[model samples]
Target chain A: MKILVPVRRVPNPDIKVRLKSDGSGVDTEGVNFLVNPFDEYAIEEAVQIVEKGGGEVVLVSIGTADCEETLRAGLALGALRGWLVETDEVLDSAAIADVLAAVFKEESPDLVITGKQSVDTDNNQAAQMLAAKLDLPQACFAFKVELGDGKATVEREIDGGLDVKEISLPAIITADLRLNQPRYAALPQIMKAKRKEVKKVSLGDLGVEAKSATKILGLAQPPARAAGQIVGSVEELVDKLVNDAKVL
Target chain B: MSTLVIAESRQGDLRAATYNTIAAAKAKGGDFDILLLGSGSAAGADSLKEFGAGTVYYSEADAVAEYTAESYAKTAAALVGEKGYTAVMMGATTTGKDMIPRLGGLLGAGMVSDVIGFDGANYLRPMFAGNAIATIEVNTPVAVMTVRETAFDAAAPSGGASAVAEAAAVGDDRAKFIEYRLTESSRPDLGAASIIVSAGRGVKDAEGVKQVEALADLLGAAVGASRAVVDEGLLPNDLQVGQTGKIVAPDLYIACGISGAIQHVAGMKDSKVIVAINKDEEAPIFEVADYGLVADFAKAVPEFMEKVKALK
Candidate 1:
């Protein structure tokens, strides 16, 4: 079994991101970048599956050379190899899905796992789009997955509940929160990761075009709430909620 | 441009988010239709007609009887192709988030997910959790999108009855639905509730959670939890409100013992009114709150319940 995991490099989610003054995009000037938090769960789940059964886990990423670091981090987590679709062009989820679909045709992995949504865009669209492009079944927002005979049983996190579905092998699964706790790379593994090979390819080399179907007009800070008063007691708070806010 | 709004339903009743999505479609300024797929869709189609849709289309074939994206997306895509809809829209519910991109792929269209508002021809959506809002435009002839339910008001009935039509259902053999297990709760749904009382890590334990629940029960509000509490296993995943969890904008949001993490604030900052009670006076949750109270939740929650009870 060969499991393909796609990782993305995103601004560290701990720090609040700021918009550019010119409103073109986010200001990446001094921000730290790391593997998106949700993608870490995908990497961990893939490695665990490969560890249980004898299989290979391959990591793939689409970005500039900076993404090689992200792929290497995944390799340290136990992936056997990495592939970087290197491009500096800003692509939307649709373009990313198209590129991944092209890679899927070449890799022919038995399973594909991805983060439910990138922390930066929060679009939550790529996995489903890739599944549709490949005509493959998909289980999105999965918190529990059990591999079976040529099939995978997945428990998806849905609104107000859990939905369990069974999908065939060679399918796509998007990782949600609570999937698993990702382990940190040990010193030895980190040292070995540097030796692992990451093959770089351009979109043209993959026979895919990086075309965006959506255009960003601008970005701005969200409207801020007015400063609140510090009520001294619970009674005062309740009164303010009922009288001043009229929300009670 | 002709638009199609997908109506979501369960147990033969239309969900509240469907109304909100309809409101979003209406805000887009066009004559729109509604599509109802799956079992128990006829009743929902009938209710949807009251929203002044041009037509309410439904399908109940065995293939599309259950809510699987494989079948539903095929059916919706076919309908979009047949009618030549310029746009397809739905509420940003779990089902919508799962299926819209598939529909977009099948149609080769551009998608804008979780839209909050519209500025002329461009759509406004939050990025980096709600810290920044981006204005985007779909460049495809057929656009696919999902609107955040909390950002729009529920559409009111326009009293113009719409025509009902039956549509053919398309099938897929790739995925099979086994079962759905809903969290059993007598309280209101967190997303749809007007009042939400959320607990945080400061609540301390399961006992603390119950105290917060007691306050929620008094006010007939839904109970929410911070990601920290949910990670600690104090609450179920469904009740978590944060960047990675449910985004909710209720009329009133009360955060108890939660330090306002940016992720947590992303989910509830759009709420009409926010009240925070934390022992830490400098908790970040207070920054976005309309009212802040510095007190131990253990003492404050019970007092809140008593005070709310005295109101009735």
Candidate 2:
């Protein structure tokens, strides 16, 4: 089984994201960047599956040349190699899906795994969009996935429960929080990752254009929350909640 | 140029989020229709008739009885094409999030997800864990979108029945639904609850979790837990409230023993009123809370139950 896992580079989630004063976009001055947390889960899942079944895990990403750093990190996690769709253009989810579909046709991997959504945009649309673009079956927000008999059984995390779905091979699966704990790359693996091959390609080479179907008008900080008062006792808290807030 | 609202149902009952999606479409100031699919769609269609829809289209074929994105997206896309709908909308529930993007892909339309509000013709959606709101514009001729249910009010019946129509069902050969294992709970659903009592790592153990539940039962509120508690196996994953979990905006949210990580704050900061109780007075959760108490939840919860009972 050859598994294709798409990853992304995002602002380190630990740092508080700040907006520009003019409401244009996020202020990225000195902010650290790393692999999106959800994509790490997808990479780990794919690597583990390949380790057990005697196959290969391949990583792909779209971003500037700096995204090679992101691919190397995935390689250290056990992927055989990487492919970077090098571009600096900001593409929306539709454009991203179109590019991935092009890569799917070129690589012809048996399976595709991706993060449910990037933490920055939080759109949560790419995997489903990609599946639709390719006319493939999809299981989104997968908590547990088992592969055998030319099919995959996925336990999906839905609103109030888990929905079990079975889809044929050559399908799309998006990782959720409980899929697996990602492992840290050891120093030896990190050094080896530096030498692993990462093939560079352009959108033009892939027969896809970086066209955005959506435009961002502006960005602004959310309204500030009011400072709260600390109560001295539980009686006072109840009195305030009942009389002042009337929320009880 | 009319909008189409996709109605969602489970176990033969219409979900409240469908009404909220209608309200969102109404807020956009346009004539909207309803599309009901799946096994019980005919019965569900009857309940949506008075919601001011221009029409209520439904399909109850066995092939489309359950939702598989491949089938539903094909069906919805075909209907959108037949009707020439300019915009399509649904509540940003799991079903909507799972299927609508595929609908957008099939229609080759630009899409937006989890829209909280509108700014003129553009959209308002959260980013970076709700720390910033971005205004977005879909440049496609046909636009597909999902609105956050908590951000809109449920549409009431408008005293007029809409024209009902039957739609063709589409089937998928690549996927099959097996089963849904729902969490059995008598308490109110966390998403729709008016009051929520949430516990944190400070709860310590399974016994501590029961204390939080007891307080929730007394106040008739839903019970929630922080990610730490859920990760520790003291609670089910569905009971978790945070960025990666369920996002709830209740009328009153009482957080006990939670330290208020930014991810947790992102999910609940939009609540109408927030109360935080923890031994550490300087926990970050206190920043967004309207009321803060510097005491251990184990000691304060019993007092809270006693005081609430006396008032009632």
The numbered model that scores best in DockQ is 1
- TM per candidate comes to 0.99, 0.98
Candidate 1 per-residue C-alpha lDDT over B114-158 given as tens digits, one digit per residue, 9 for 90 to 100: 999989878999999889999998998999999999888999998
Model 1 chain A worst lDDT run, 10 consecutive residues: A239-248
lDDT of 1: 0.91
RMSD of each: 1.0, 1.1
Predicted candidate 2 versus true structure: per-residue lDDT over A47-126, tens digit per residue: 99988997888999999999999999889988999899999888899999999999999899999999988988888988
Q: In model 1 chain B, where is the ten-residue run with the lowest total lDDT?
A: B8-17
Candidate 1, pairs of clashing residues: none
Tell me the TM-score of model 2. Answer: 0.98
Q: Give the TM-score of candidate 1 (chain A).
A: 0.98
The C-alpha stretches of model 1 lying farther than 4 A from their native spots are: none
Which tens-of-lDDT digit does each residue in B28-145 have in candidate 2? 8789999999988998999899989999999998778988888999999999999999889999888899999999999988898888898877889988888999999999988899
What candidate 2 gets wrong by more than 4 Å, as runs, is: none
Every candidate's DockQ is 0.86, 0.83
